[model samples]
Target: MLDAVVVGAGISGIYQLYRLRQAGLSVQLCEAGDGVGGTWFWNRYPGARFDSESYTYGYFFSRELLDEWSWSEEFAGQPETERYLNHVVDRFDLRRDIRLGARVSAAVYDDAAAAWTVTVENGERLRARFLVTAVGPLSEPYVPAIPGLAGFAGVWHHTARWPREPVDLRGKRVAVIGTGSSGVQVIPHIAAEAAELVVFQRTANWCTPINNRPITPERMREIRRTARTIHRTCQETPGGFVHRPLSVSALEVGEEERRERFQRLYDAPGLTMVLANYRDITTDRAANAAVTDFLRGKIRERVKDPEVAERLIPTDHTFGMKRPPLEDGFYEVFAQEHVSLVSLAEEPILRFTPAGIQTAARHYEIDVAVLATGFDAVTGAIRRIDIRGRDGVRLDRHWEAGPRTHLGLQSAGFPNLFFVGGPQSTTGNIPRATEIQVDWVMDCLRHMADHGHRYVETTPAAEEAWLAHVESTVRGTVLEDATSWAFGSNVPGKPRVYQLYAGGIPQYRARCAEAVEAGYTGFVFG
Candidate 1:
């Protein structure tokens, strides 16, 4: 029996395995895929890239590793990112500890032994004192419930699960569905190759320029100088990206300055243009309008057809509520003669025909279809695993309405079972959140080991209190109104509770700290 077993070999899983190994713990990492790089390994579509940019969307644990790797682009594609992760595995010698092509089927807490017996699909059973689920937020792909999605005779693909080999869309009529981040990034590439590309937009999405360019050698060296400081500062930021150098808040800049910078910023691309309004865009309606309108005007200018441009511009939700998209010429691609936008709200998908898709308006024939529908997110991966706690109660049955856990890590009934990015996790608690979380779990494990403890679980009170706090946080912000995967609003039949903590990332850090300082208060340490 190993000391610990980690599920999923993504970025988080890789780091988790390394940390435990460095602590001289007996641990093994299991992945269902053939290799490492969880998301990067599967999503190999044309324009699939990271929104957080190249250098810092990686492990910051080792200075040598940080300094050694060189990024090929400002925002890395799926292939390049995969290579980097594989290199991390090779350089750190993480292969021996990893069991690839092995999917954990079920995990049950055996009260008699006080250990989790994990069963793999191939009938391999392994027991460990701790079972950590490092399954990512976007692990499972979601396909829409359109009447006849499977009936379409030709090729159909989800962006999340795109084919590993090259696809030929040239001279083929293609229909692309969904307008989220991946949809926005991929449409242009699809349009370029297809004879005619019809984009099905259920909701018009807000888009900012990616402004991606090759990271110059000179700039790379300069970043290397302050790499440690930058890495530390990013932990402090909300979304894990390096914030702009402007110290003053957007409100501090003048109106004229704001207008000029907003225009300049809008053109500059990446995330810099997201805040041209020079004020708080989240709560303040006017500030949010300023940013949204600027992007709308940009779309109008680039798209050739006025009707298509109007269809492309989103009017309903707040900017940050849904995951924001970034691209250089996504809007411009619509100007192409072969490209057209189909408003799904205007013309709902009636069904899929043998040769084409039948929207309410008309039937458009296509050779290939791209279902850019996003993942079930946050809850999907954990739900996929069959986890039974002390009473042989399933995690899914307990979470039928919604998911609930203390600190999104430990559940009340599940003793000795752990989750890395679990429910009730304060995701908004920026830079220090993940650092604080991993530390807390490790501390709990170490404490249990030293004291001859068997299994430590959260009290029902702790789970309920933390769950209420998470709900309150989500309802307090614009996030509650966000009808995206973040709130489980996109997928039907799933509970409508908030999956991530909307309170500021820094605030979350303090709460976790307080819990630890109070000797893991509310946790039942046996």
Candidate 2:
């Protein structure tokens, strides 16, 4: 049996495999995709780019790797991001151990042998002492159950599963559904090409400007010089970004000063508008409302039509409640003559007809359709795989109410199984968060090896305590009130539970450190 088997060759999986192999352990990685890069590889839609600064989103473990790769833009596009991941894989020679096109169908734990037998879709099975699921939280694409999709004559594609080949939308009548992050990004590019473009939005989201620009040679040099400092800032901040919120609350500031600060952030690059905003904007009702009003005003100013502008503005939730996408001229796209906005809430979609979508009010004729509907999120990817632990307990059934785990790492009754970037994990700057998780898992594995333990799992009491801590941490935050994918609200019938650990990165790290100090408390190894 191998020492470990890691599923999904994404950022987390790649790093995990590298760390495990470096420790002289027999480790193998399995990727479902034909190629590596996981999220970047599959999400090849137009205008897909980094919201986080390119530097902060990449691996910080190697100074050599950081010095070699130079990003072209402050926020690199999908192509560049995919290439960067491929570069990392090649640089580390990680491909030989990674089996491409090997989708994991089931992982069953053998209590007697103290090993996990992982079955791939291709009838291949691998037994390992430990199993690490690096399958990303957002890996499973979620397409809404709209009737007559199969009967429609026009071609339809989910944004997550966009074809590798370039899609020709030139002069074609197109309909784009859902206005989440991907929708906002791809809609602008589609509008520029399609003869008639219709955007179907169920709920309007808070979007700020990306303001992406090419990185000059001078800036690249400066970035390389301050690479350590940049990574340090990400480590120190709450959201794992270089952007830090102000110390004072928005309620503490004057209206004039607050509006001015909001405007500056509006014009600034990346997610600074939200991540670097007032301290209380995400917590205090009045502070969140003030920032929300400012953003609504900006949206109104950009869109020429008053009705369309009003449709674009979100009314239900606060500004930072849902994860906001950084956009480039997104609101301005509606100003174009050929581009139209269809509010799904006002006129719900009846079904997909032969020509296009038929709503309650009217039918939209289109040649092509694009679904930007998001993912099942945190627990979806792992739950899809048939995972059986002790006593043939099903993972999906165990998490039917919601995910139960200790620090999002391991669940009770699931021996030798670990999760990185899974449910109850950190929220922002995914790569940075996953890096921290991977390091901790490696440490835990080392601990097991040194102690000559073959099986390990979290205690039921520990898992319950961690779940309680997660709930308590997000109890009063704005996130608890919002009905978004962050809380698993987008998927119908899915448990509406807070999916991520709302605690800051520093606190999470400290908690892990405490576990180590207490001899890996709440975990049993035999």
Candidate 3:
């Protein structure tokens, strides 16, 4: 039996495998796809790019990797991102231990042996002393159960599961559903090529300009010089980003000054508008409203039609309550005559017609339909696998009310099973957050080995306390009440619970360190 089996070849899994192997453990990485790069590998949809700065989003574990690879764009697109991950794999010679196309069907823990037997879809079973699931939060795609979807004559594809091969949208009338991050990114690109484009927005999201630009040689040199600073800043910040919110509240400034501050943030690149704005934009209702109104006004200015502009503006949630999309020419696309917006709130999608989509108002005849419907998120990927722990208790059933874990790492009764970048973990700048988690997991495993521990599982009391802490951290924040994917609201029948640690990187890191310092206080080892 191998020391550990990591389920995913994504950012988290790749790093976890490398760390485990470096520690002299026999580890294997299993990827569902035919290749590496997990999310980047699958999300090959039009206009797929980083909302985070390319440099900040990448791996910072190796100084050599940082110095050698320079991002072409401020926010690198899918192809480049995929290539970067492939480069990492090849550079580190990680391909030998990775099993491609090995989708994990089930993972069952043997109580007597204190080991896990992971079964792949191909009927191969790999037994390992420990199991680490790095199956990303957004890995499992969520497609709405619209009637007559299978009978639709035209081609349809979910944005998350976009084909690796080229999908020709040129000259064809297309309908894009859902106005989440993926929808916001793909719509503009589709409008540029498709003969006619119809965007069906369920709840219009708060979006800001990405302002992506090429990284010049001079900028690359500067980035390399300050790589250490950049990484340090990322670790120090709340969201694990180089961007940090100002200390002063938005209410402290005058109306004109607030508008000017919002404008500067609006024109800025990536998530600066949200992450680097005033401190209370996400917490205080009045402060959030000030920023929200500023954003709404910007949307109105971009779209020429007043009615269309209002339709695109969100009414339900504040600016940062739901995760906003960083877009390029997204609002401007609605100004184009051939492109149209269908407010699903006004006329909800009834069903799928043979030609295209049929809403409550009319039938949209289109050659293609793209479901930018988004993912089940957080727990979906882990829950997809039939994971059984002590006494054959199912992981899905255990988490039916929502995910329960200590530090989003280990659940009670699931000894030797850990999660990286999954539910109840850090929320922002994912790679950085996952890096922190993977390092902590590595440290935990090392502690286990040093202590001659064969099995490690979190105590029920610790899991309960952690869950309570998570709820308390987000209790009064805008995110706590928002009905978004952050709380599994997008998926029907999924329990609506706060699924991520919103207390920032430093706080989460300190808590993890405390657990370790307390001799892994919450965990029981055998």
* lDDT per residue (tens digit) for residues 37-102 in model 1: 888888888999987767767777778987888887888889999999999999999989999999
Tens-place lDDT digits, model 3, residues 97-124: 9999999999999999999999999999
Q: Could you tell me the lDDT of residue 410 within candidate 2? A: 95
lDDT for residue 488 in candidate 1, whole number 0-100: 82
lDDT of 2 by residue, 227-320 (tens): 9999989988888999999999999989999999999998899999888999989888889889999998989899999999999998777798
- Where model 2 places Cα greater than 4 Å from the true spot, the runs are none
> lDDT at 83 for candidate 2?
95
lDDT of each prediction vs. the true structure? 0.80, 0.92, 0.92
Backbone clash count for every predicted candidate, in the order shown: 8, 0, 0
Q: Would you estimate the TM-scores of all the predictions?
A: 0.95, 0.99, 0.99
Q: State the displacement of the C-alpha of residue 387, model 2, in Å, after optimal TM-score superposition.
A: 0.4
Off by over 4 Å in 3: none
